[model samples]
Target: MTDNRQSLADLASLTNQPAPAAPAAQSLPTSEGDIAAPVSNEPVREPMPLREQILDKQGRAYATGRRKDAVARVWVKPGTGKITINGRDQEVYFARPTLRLVINQVFGITEREGQYDVVCTVKGGGLSGQAGAVKHGISQALTRFEPVLRASVKAAGFLTRDSRVVERKKYGKAKARRSFQFSKR
Candidate 1:
């Protein structure tokens, strides 16, 4: 520490040096100051929550969906509507129009029908379970592709997984809930 009064006086008397000029590559940014500020003090409204944006290099959204014992790995891409399952067309794989309808309900709710191409592989369940799993997967993938659709998809209830599984058979029961016929003999 300098105890000298001369050093203290020099520091106090020193003038600021000229600032270096910005490079040609850099320029001072312009600001729009308070252009939208509320004039009245009644209340300053909070900004709305923004939806998360998701981007994929290949322009695809991938998701895994499950229902009962079924699981489906799904991929969605922007294109004319086409749904493929395990290398077969949905029509061929699902057979029934009702099953196809179940898988397409998300698109119906979001009004994005015929907008995306879907390719998925499902395993470990029957046809109905597989269809439900695909529907769940489609809803999840739609949200991932466009987060802004979350509200619509969630409202339509496709984002929620069906957790109901087959009930375990009791040792004394013929089936999951069935009891052996009682005989008074």
Candidate 2:
């Protein structure tokens, strides 16, 4: 039997080509024991393109937000901080302190309290859900008004919509998961 395999050097010689060069050795450390940082061969990445500010002819930023069964339409403009919901002041619309806090959380995180005016209309859900919807709307409007704040607001997890909703009831169940009472004879 004849050997068919050929070494890389033998193939190179037959092809009239020089052998491939070996990888370079790592640099030695200096007498001070300080080793140079390794250089990366990776290409440098370019920074992401910035988002553009969106505004209406009236100079207001508009956005819509939804949570659970509630939906809110919001408009943001530069002014002393004032929030109106459903044609009423925030205090009147959301009497509970916690609800008010939920509505203002975005502003608090951006450290932009008392710097803008917000007008929103929310419907279709209970108080808690409505408050959440309003908060989501405000965050979206703020980002639209000042695109630079997008990174911070997104980092705080306000940009993503809340997708949780009530599960549908099954045909044989009393509620989504509760079973009907059994009868004993």
Measured by TM-score, the strongest candidate is 2
For residues 31-92, what per-residue lDDT tens digits would candidate 1 score against the true structure? 54624333466776885575665546887899999999999999999999999999999989
Model 2 C-alpha lDDT per residue in residues 26-80, reported as the tens digit of each score: 3555556787678899998997777889999999999998999999999999999
Clashes of each: 0, 0
| lDDT of the candidates, in the order given | 0.86, 0.90
TM-score of the candidate numbered 1? 0.73
Compare the candidates by lDDT and give the number of the best one: 2
For candidate 1, the clash count comes to 0
Q: For model 1, what is the alpha-carbon lDDT of residue 37?
A: 35
Cα displacement (angstroms), candidate 2, residue 121, comes to: 0.8
Error of 1 at 17 (Å): 65
